[model samples]
Target: MRRKHLLNTFAAAALRIFMLLTLGVMMTLETKADISEEYPDFYTGAEGTNTKGINFVQSITVLAPEYCSSVMGDFTVVFKAPGMKYIKAFCWRQPTDKNPGKWGHDAVLADMELKEGEMGKFVVKGDEFPNGPMTIRIHAKDDKNKQDICELQLYNLGGVKWNQGIPDRDPPGAAGMARVFADDFDGPLSISPDGMNARYAAHKTGGGDFSGWQFSDPHGENQPFAQRDTFLRIHASKPLGTQGRSGILSSLRPDGTGVAVSIPSYFECRFVAQSAPGTWPAFWTLTKNTIGMDKNDPTFEKISKMGSDELDIVEAYGGYGHKNPNSGGVYSSVSHFWGQPKPDWNQRKLADGSENTDFKPSSFRTDTLQLGGKSSWSWTFHTYGLAITETDTIYYFDDIEIGRHPTGEVSKALPAWFLINYSIGGISGWQIDMERYGNKTDMWVDFVRVYSGCVQAPEVSASGFPGAKPAVVTMSASTRGAEIRYTLDGSEPSEKSTLYTSPVSVSQPCTIKVRGFGKNLKPSPVTEYILTTPPGVQGSIGINFVTDMADSEQALAPGDVTGIAPYIQGNWNNVLAGTKTTSRFSTSDGATSPVTLNIEGEAKPEKGEPWGFSGNDRRLKRGNLVSNPRFTLAGIPYAKYDVVVILGAGIHNVQGEIHLAEAESGNHIDAFSFDYGWNGGQHAIATTKPGEAAKNTNYIVFRNVTQKDITITMKWGSGKGWTGVAAIQIVPQKD
Candidate 1:
């Protein structure tokens, strides 16, 4: 085992080395091509060093594809430069004499000051540019007046596909959930009055920020938020007065009025971390009454007396090497319950025996859970989710369970609104060394989504097959307190549609559509069913065979004996070994047939079949385990009937085998193999199966069963060597 482990480790190391080499080759080739075609003679300056040590701008490289088919969401830019004053991005569709290189001041998308050797990361919104191929140039300049520029082309599709490859991060017990709020940042950022007409508010309405930086426009006059490649870019740049200018988007407005979800809900965000030192990016939530409107609102009283809650779903601290150990690879999810009576940081307890006002932990319900990821948070995108249930608060990273804690008392009592922010060094003790990153950084968010329980689509079931006669169809929805509305004339079902009180009798051929609606819940998806009658067929012809020990009262068979397609019911008629009995079966259509069943082997059948087996448990799914049943049928009336044999026991994983052949001709007809545990092959009842217009699993139909006399042999396939023959069906096909 040790030798095998060593071999596996060596193989993994070799594979990683090979991948790195391949990536290096690809990047080298891409850089060469970009420099050769896109860069003009002046853009590619000589490597003669004048002031800065290396003159790194001559071969400036943007760590991305030179030509992107669809640029939606924020993309990272990594360049090599030993010293530079600033690096900026500009975009234009076509170059003209007025702006020959499309590098006009109007085309400037983002400009940031970078320290020596620090890369310039900016958010480029695709919609800000045109739809066709657009030229984007990244320009960098040193204090020595020496500068370098590189250009790349990108195609904008104008839409964000954020849902692609995103994992479903629904928490346990969060079933029957519906999306309540979603923001993909696919278009221009909308900043309305208190976020009333917009998805996000530019700044905090009540104005109490924990970070050293204030929430303002990082780009001076413009809003700090930008939509890039279907992502929200929050820029954090140079300081203003005592604090720096950063970006933050709050769901709550200035009046403390905004969208907020209650307890037992889920909130999630997919984002790429900034990871630059002194930068702090967070996706967190606060109680509705957290920051009231200047002590005038009644919510202010609640904050003073009852206190508020802060659920930090993710608080990512940036700093590669700093006093604080946290970096791009580690993040924390904390639940902070503020102390009551005019909440303040002084109320928090210090780590020492005595409490200190500065740099101390607050709230008795302070549960901070730190999680690590395989790669740096800024390297790629990752989803951070929080499931707030009645009893527990669960946190997830990339849909995988990370840490969980008990629900805070205050959090359970109040509704919460979310906030996404890019903060600069403040309360967090991490060093603010922006010199490495040129003093500017960015936080990118792919999307933010929240979900709660809502109305669910109704499951439709039919009593009989669609034909000349009426079929009673029942509609049932899973969501509690939801009302089901349906339409029979094929029109879309709405709240005004006919309320489903009882079973709907669908006569002739028609379409049935249903939808569920409830108070404070999103309506369910419209479920449609096209009911059609078979051509030239008054009714169907079928037969069902069960063991003698099985309950005869159960409606396990697909078609009823008295339905449009009458099916004959039969039993195995268990007797002594070598027993031969001729059972005459009668159909609802008055079709009588003589089926001579000659059992030559031992008939080992289980005792007393359970009732209600076919209703919820699916009849024939679990049944008696029998052995060695060789039955020969001489008289089959139909010239062409689909013979379906149910093999395997649902309760066990035993394999069962069945082979059928012409009795007189001794020619092979067909064979089937199944394992009860796997539920292999066709295993569903055709008529009652949902979305099964015709065929079903476990409904193996032998089309060319022309001969009347056929022999069926059943035995165990493999595994435990114990299998059961629950039932069989024969449906007549069209001539």
Candidate 2:
């Protein structure tokens, strides 16, 4: 065993050296020639409508000699509509016999959106289109509703030939829970619902607008960027093309067949909530076959009872009325069987065949889950999932089990398809304040996944996978061939982010996050590996704590590192639990009112780094704090190199002075301070304002004047205040 371990270590060292030498070369590989030049007539025709007076399609060319049908994550869609703004394009495998209009049931090869006359270069991921006789549609719209489109050509990057090599994607979940259904809405919700019911019909309760909700924007903005996200927004608004309206999407296929799953499965979707008072967003499943039909008919009741099984995985309107308990964001789930009682046709029945009219206790029941904060559901993406088994049905928020129900007869009910709607003004008596909430509310969906067969997510065991070596952890792909992307700060991976070409090297105990990417495979779940350092692996020790729990940065003094406030008040507990964009690390101050400053991951250093902490948990972000922001720390020096601070945030054209001082002697050492004047000087990373639509705030590197071993304090401030500084690592370097 010892010999093998030594051999593994040496192998790892060799691999690392090899990769270091080859990485630069790999990054420099150029894209192959255009498919249009290589494969002529890939596209037979292209057209544009509603463009006022402009020709929408710039050009259409083919790359491979064949069509793209089942090929994705391995091809690129290239096009341009320079004459028009707001382009919405869809590329699909159009069959030789089926016309473009009949392309409904066929899979969408790609969904691309371009805003403000942008080029197609930013429209889609490289080589993501499938192989087949392709049909392309470009819906270009102006701010005033004028539309246009342009033909697209394929550009091959990575020299990926169809079927020449395998596709890279997230592995499917484990067996029994393996994925049975899935859609990122990469295109439109091609599947239609059974029929229009009361939910689809406009409700008078809050003057709701039915038919107002939409799928991917025909006007752009629905495009998820590779580095961030591309999602479909279910928007609720006061009539644009018409009047006050809400949105609804049925899961029934337009071909008349229902989309209900025939077996027990899980339905999961990541949604950005529209949590205002008047807005009601929900993810629910119903008996697709029986919906919009008469429940009073006995035959309908018996055979259709199979169709009336309804599961409300999430109803966001539950937070209304109960101000205290429901103060924070909350959702409700209910189970219902519309099989009416034998004699009482007006009442619904339970699994046991009983009828309860007044309380309707058995007819329908609800379970509520408080989401902790009022704004909890409004800002970020949270997953709501329904796990349906033969005997059990469960609801989840961000993967944590929230409510459960016996499968009873409902579990035995027919298959169900998901219906996502942004509703409003129902008669349920929830609060309605559209005037206060505004005329427009948006609900964004990242993806919807349905699974059965006891499938679990890909097992990401640091121990089990091959490439078994010290400091190297391999993630198990779901038996399906795929490539994985990873991050250290817990954010989900994006196509634009770094690709995991090989197992990562971890010198610190930071969290390494992994996610799979596959072309035709199911959605790959993000798996986090929380590495623990060996006792001997500890780096240089330094004090870490939160200086304040307020929204603003507090002044840092020599003794304020620990003694200034109790640890409890610092709200250090947040770092202990992590959930990607949420959770933070802090030093609490008990004397304070258990106050906390929230700093999501990426904004702070790994838990073990010396001086690794957000100063104000509530101030998890210091990039925008401008009023003399200061940070102080004292520790045994890690080395005698010059002081250099690595800062991660957005500071495009900002200038500031960073001050460094010796904490114990209160001495401003040699070459103590440097003024950060970006936009012209050498920049490590430059970006726009922080917390805005822009990414990263880009990391900034500053070389300090002094180098020493004594505990040090550093501060950055500008007359305009500060940009965001998510986290700072004091690395040893002079340049």
Candidate 3:
């Protein structure tokens, strides 16, 4: 029994060894198969009826054969496991060098257990891997003992490619590239938002986007020179299709006064290219009829019946360095003329020695000119511009002029509306690689401008008075070649109005109308003004006083009262005094003079009383006799009269009255007087009345009627002695 049992144990151990060896062989075979092929073969589980195992393991890895120049879409890894009791899959980013080994770097593990004897697949998308050369490790583990690993290589592939070649045929041709129709106008183009200094409108497809175009007018004063002067400016966001050229258009009309259009010698249009992997944008002008140039010559003739002129401004190629490089650095410029070129032909040079060359066209090319030596033109932004004038033509890129044309008088009048566009490759020599540049390249048009003739003012007129000269009438044009027309009839002036040769002369009141007209028949608004001269004046008046009297006493004393009084008397009687009863005194002579006295009078002197000279003396009393006794001299001559009164006696309480006669009519004059009192030194008085009659005697009477016994003497005319008189005379008026 013991021997039998031992043998049984030995057999069992032998079976175990055989089983382990078989398993190792199967694993070896599986590994070899996976290593020999790009994809791994699936392993069956331990169930013979289902040769599957409880735990199965499978793995996969991807290796990039070589670095891909370009990559598109996503990279993927796929695998399937069949006949496994259950399976779990794991994927990890691995280096090509470490394929089919433990994924040491960052990795994602799928450790899900599956049902017995089930089939499963594992897939990993490309983005999961790194950019450079890489590998993907895919591992599948099932319920069975089998484990498998597979490695796949990854590569880089770039974007799609495309090409736009030149046009195979030509479109119909209109007159010259640029033509100014006779119907064009020279007046200000009426812009909607009236006062706007400068503005531009563009026509584009696909909902226009102008972000790519940059605009700048450093000097804010001047308007951008557009159709009237030269061309428009455009820039591209990507390589433009060269299949068709771009177009820039303009229109002109008479403002109001008349109908005429003035043209410049030359004009310009400009464009820029997108600096991308592959892109080339070109600018060109074409007749309105041959937009695509699909129609033949006969078709162009039919279109020409509609009146249109076309011109190509510039064109460029983004690829080929024949002129520019594959990287994009080439440009070209050309101008088309309508009929015969003008006398001072070349528009590039002005008579003033200034360059008329357009800076827009050559600006972009010169910017990348330095890159021309390189194999590929470095992708970068570019700018271009073109300017044309009656006497000159200029072309520029980014403010840099690349070309110029000296042909003067390109057009006698401004050209009709023309078209401007940017094309990738078209009739012009432009061939661009669309693939390198992407699907679409953007072309931006900043604006189009026209600068033509200046507006002129009208004539002015003056009227009413003689020798009235018309105000200087000044006029100016927006550009040039504008003539001023004016009339003095107050009527609106037209083109037929008389031309203003010089300032108008006005001797009488009149209204003037003025207007400005261009050589092309375009007219400006009429300006009008009314003028009147002033009238004249007549005869005058003059008067003067000649006197020998310098001193105040002499100037105020009466001529008849010659002497001064020394003593006080009981009844002081002089030619200046009058009796209380009569109340009047007459002067010895017809002349009159003024006098001063110290006395009292119950009744003041009457007209011509106490008078000594040519004028009457009328005494004017103040209040009642009880109050202060005050009197004024009256009836003085129409001329200046001087008077002086003197007191020679002791202090006396008395009332004094002095009077003068009025002068005759037509007498316009003035008077003055001076007085001297008894202890009180001197004083003065004067008088004059308009239209008063002159008289012989003017007197001043004094009556000693005070309660106290007062004694005083009076004097006039130098006031030396009691020459006595109530009045005096000194003058006959002089002029």
lDDT of 3: 0.30
* Model 3: per-residue Cα lDDT over 1-735, one tens digit each: 000111112222222221222233222223222221211222332322121221222222222222112234453333344433323333224334554332223344344444544434334444544332233333343333444433222332321111111112211111122222111212333221111111222222111212122111111112222222111222222324332222222221111111112333223332323432223344433223332223464665554444332233444434321222322234445555434443244345677878856422211223233322111111222334444444445555544456655423323223323333443443323334334222333333333322333343332322112231223333333334567777778888887888876655454556767777765434655666554332111000000011112312112221111222211111112322232211122222211223222334332322111111110110110001111122233333334322333222211222222333222231212222323233222212313222332222122222221111112222123323221222222222233
**Candidate order, TM-score descending:** 1, 2, 3
| Collision count for each candidate, in order | 13, 79, 183
Candidate-wise lDDT, in order: 0.53, 0.38, 0.30
- Which scores better on TM-score, 1 or 2? 1
lDDT score, residue 684, model 1?
44
Can you write out model 2's per-residue Cα lDDT over 1-735, one digit (the tens) per residue?
000111112222221211121112121111221223222422111121111122112222223322212234544445554444443444433223343332122233334445644555323333433231123433343332222322222222322122211113322222245454455645533321112111121111112223322222111122211111234545455533434545555555322222345445677776655444445677777655544335684656666544356677776552222111122233456776556323233246645777644222222212222232212343334567777777566777655676665564645655566677766544343444444223455565667666654212333333211112234555544323456667777677665556766656555556777766655444454566666432211121112223232212322221112111111111122211122222122221111121122323223332111111222321232223232334443332334333323332233333433444564475765222223333221223423222223222223333343433233233343334234333333333223
Q: Where does candidate 2 have its weakest 10-residue lDDT segment?
A: 1-10
Candidate 1 TM-score over all chains jointly: 0.39
For model 2 the TM-score comes to: 0.31
